[model samples]
Target: MAKGVWIVAEQRDGALRKVSLELASTARKLADQLGDEVSAVLLGSGVEAMAAELGKYGVDKVYLADNPAFEPYTTDAYAQAITKVVKENDPAVLLLAASAQGKDLAARLVGSLATGMASDCTDVKIVDGKLYCTRPMYAGKCYGEVVVDSFPQMASLRPNVFPLVENAKAGAVVKFEPALGELKTKVVEIQKEASGKIDVTEANIIVSGGRGMKGPENYVILEELAALLGGAVGASRAAVDAGWRPQSDQVGQTGKVVSPNLYIACGISGAIQHLAGMSSSKYIVAINKDPEAPIFQRADYGVVDDLFKVVPALTAEVKKLL
Candidate 1:
């Protein structure tokens, strides 16, 4: 029988990502409820030091697979490595973040293990000794509970939705060698965003714009406000389609899903596609000239005015507060 809770912890450049901690913390909660130990898989070059960090978040053991091939994160290499560790341990529950990398890895792992998986889950809990996952459906119109019947029930949780808690444990390290036979893929190069820019999915607060932004140059105001709040700037599909923002900054069903503590939508009419990406935010504020804009229906707070004027005034007020 499968036992214990397992998480595939994600790291970049030898540093653990915030989602990794969230996964560990969530696994800890589920493991405690099931009276099982929590173990984490850390794959990266020279990431042994990160094992202790996972321990701080309640992981009892860290399965370290340190190799040069794991640094760049090829799907094949990681899939093989994680599948090996999971097969060896036979964990009852497996959790991963729903971020881009996690989603990619989970898809491959599910195929490799021939197990069922729940994707983009907002909440997970132990239900009658089985893993129950809650996920949004039909573009956030409704939610559905999922239960995987296969061994090592798997779920991918949305990043930033789960809380990070510190519950220190032994954090024992168990080194393992991955049998990755001749790989089919290789990383040639990686283009990254400008230094200090945060991904919208990981931001605690987001100031997003849409077609109301007018043009790319007008994003300066949004950027100022976002910088003031120590948050990231996001764009709706309209904004990205209009070439006002990069694809990475787009937030919607066709873009990136974000669940920040606060989401401020500027000049956005609140299309269903856009709502699907950020409807999970704790609080939503919408700014639009039309009172009947679709976005106002979902916003916790609505401002019926031109975003151009509203954004500048809001930025000034924020500056004063700081």
Candidate 2:
């Protein structure tokens, strides 16, 4: 029977992503609630050192699945390796970040194990002795508590919603060997996006723009503010669909979910679809001309004014502080 909570640690370029640590921190909370141990599954080539970081977040054990073929993210390779680990350990709960790689892995895991999974969960906890997960539905207009009838309940949590917590743990590292399988798909090319800017998921402050910005060219002001603050830039679906920003920068129901300490929505109308993605942020600031905009309802601070005039002034003020 599954006993402890397990976190699937994500690594890229031999470095563990912040989501991995965040998920481990979240797993620690759930494990404490259930009086269960928190374990981690780290898979990659020469990634044994990454396991030590998980131990800092209260992990009881780190199951290392090291392999040369696992250097980069390949769906077939990762799924097969993770499946092997799950079958062997049978963890009580499996937590992963709802990232593109994570979503693909979760779906593959569900197919392999024939188990139910809740995707892009916003909240998770044990309720009445069963794992209850809260997820947005109908484009964030509604929410529901989901229960998976599988032994090892699986859920992919949205990034940034959970804070990374640190706790001392003498986690024992256990190396695991998986039965090798033939690669079904080959990665011939990898086009990496220019990402020197702050990662949105890891940013402490985020300033997002929407249709109210009018055009793609108008995003310069938003970018300036974000750069000054050392924050990441985000966009609404409308702005993204208009080709103002890359799809990766979009933050809404059909885009990335982020929870930062400060989320500044500039010119965004605050549709429920968009709110579903960022309502969990610690503090929200909305800037829109319409005083009655829906986003103002959720914002901790609301500025009723034209973004064109207000944003530049705000940027200047921020620049002065710098």
Candidate 3:
């Protein structure tokens, strides 16, 4: 029979990602309800030392697969390693973050492991001794609930969707090694962009702009404000499609979904697609000249003034304060 709850604790450069801790906290809550232990799998070259950090987030065991082969996050190598762990442990559930890596790993793992998998889940609940997960469907037009009908039920929770609860425990580090064969594909070079910029999905504050900015050059004002607030800059589909911003900066149904503490929409019309992505934000501030703009309806703070004027003023005031 499947036993403990397992989570794939993702890491980059030997540092655990925030979503991994979020997954551990969710697992901790689920384990409490199911009367099982919360365990985590950490796979990286020198990530064994970070197991203790997972303990603070309520992980009880850290299955360490520290090897040089797992350094660059090759798809097949990770899939092989995780599948081996699941075969040995027979966990009741396997959770992963809905990140680029997590998405790839989870899909490949499920294909080989024969488990029902849900992606981009916002909530996981224990319903009548079953793992029930909620995720957006139909392009976020609505939500759907799912229950995995197999052991080692799998789900990838969206980043920032779950709160990171500080429930300290003994995350006993258990060393394990898997014979990861020669990877068919290998990463040669990784060129990270805007190295200091926080990930849009992971940022606590995000400043997003749309077509109302007139052109790409006007985005400077938004960037200035974002820099002042130490936040990431995001763009709507309209801005991205117009070639004003890179596709990576898009925030919408076809883009990265974010649930930041503060989301500032500049010149964005609050289209359904845009709202579908960031409606979960704790607080929304909208700045648009059009009074009838749909964004005003959802914003906690609305400014019916041209962003050209308001944004510069806001940035100047912020700069003064800083």
Candidate 4:
């Protein structure tokens, strides 16, 4: 029988991502409930030092695959390494982040391991020693619970939805060497964002714009406010479609799903597609000229006014508080 809870920990540029710690902490809770140990599969070059960090979050063991080929993250290389580990030590439940990389890898693992998986889960709990995952359905209109009956139930959790906890453990390391007989894909170049902007999915606060923004230049105001609040600027699908912002900044069903602590929607009419992405925000504030805008219905606070005037005033108030 599968006995231990496992997580595929993610790291980038030699530092562990916040989602990895979230996965570790969540796995710790589930493992304790099941009376099992929590283990993590860490794959990257020069990432052996990160094992101690995972241990601080209640992971008892780290299966280290320290190989240069693991860096730059090719789907083929990671799938081979992770599949080998899971096959060697069968885990009861496997948890991963719902980020771009996690989603890609989890899909491949499901095919290779022949197990069931829940994608982009917002919540997960162990009921009767089984994993029950909660995920949004039909553009956030409803939620459904998922259970994978197969051994080593897999789930990819959404980023920032789960809390991080520190529970120290032994953090023992077990080195594993994967026989990767690969020759399929190669990382030629990686183009990174020049502005070092925060991803909306992982941000605590988001100040977003839409058609009311008028033009891309007006986004500077939102950026100023976001900088002051240590948040990020997001755009609606309309803004992205109009070329006012990059697709990466878009928040909607066709774009990225965000669950920030606070979401400030400016000038956006709140189309169902857009609402489907960010409706799960803890607090939503909508500023629009039209009082009947659909976004007002979902916003916790609604301001019936022009966003051009409202955003500047709001920025001033934030500056005063700072």
TM-score of each: 0.98, 0.94, 0.96, 0.97
Residue runs of model 4 more than 4 Å from their true location after superposition:
none
For model 2, the run of ten residues with the poorest summed lDDT:
193-202
Q: How much lDDT does candidate 4 score?
A: 0.93
User: Model 3: per-residue lDDT, tens digit, 1-322?
Assistant: 8988999998997689999999999999999999999999998887877899999999999999988888889889999999998999999989999888999899999987988988999999988878999999876778999999997899999898799899999989999999887689988899898788787888999999999999999999998999999999999999999999999889988898898999999999999899888887889999999999998888999999988999899889988998
**Model 4 lDDT per residue over 155-207, tens place:** 99988888999999978999999999864999999988766688888799999
Candidate 1, residue 37: CA error in Å? 0.3
- Top-down lDDT ranking: 1, 4, 3, 2
Instruction: Report the lDDT tens digits of candidate 1 across residue range 1-322.
Output: 9999999999996689999999999999999999999999999898999999999999999999889999799998999999988998899999998989999999999998999999999999998999999999999999999999997899999998999999999789999998898889999999999999989988999999999888999999999999999999999988898888999999999999999999999999988899999999999999999999999899999999989899999999998998
Predict model 3's lDDT versus the native: 0.91
Instruction: Please report how far candidate 4 places residue 236 from its true position, in Å.
Output: 0.8
Higher-scoring candidate on TM-score, 2 or 4: 4
Candidate 4, residue 7: the lDDT equals 97
Clashing pairs in 2: none
Q: For model 2, how does the per-residue alpha-carbon lDDT over 1-322 read when each residue is reduced to its tens digit?
A: 6789998899887789988988888899999989999999888888888877888988889988788778778889888988988888888899988987898889899888778889888889997656899988887777888999897899999887777899867567898888868989888889877857776766878999999999989999998999998899999999999999889888877787788889999989999889977888899999999999999999999999999998899999998998
* Candidate 1 Cα misplacement greater than 4 A, ranges: none
The segments of candidate 3 whose C-alpha lies over 4 angstroms from its true place after superposition are none
Better of 3 and 4 by TM-score: 4
Q: What is the lDDT of residue 322 in candidate 4?
A: 84
Better of 1 and 4 by lDDT: 1
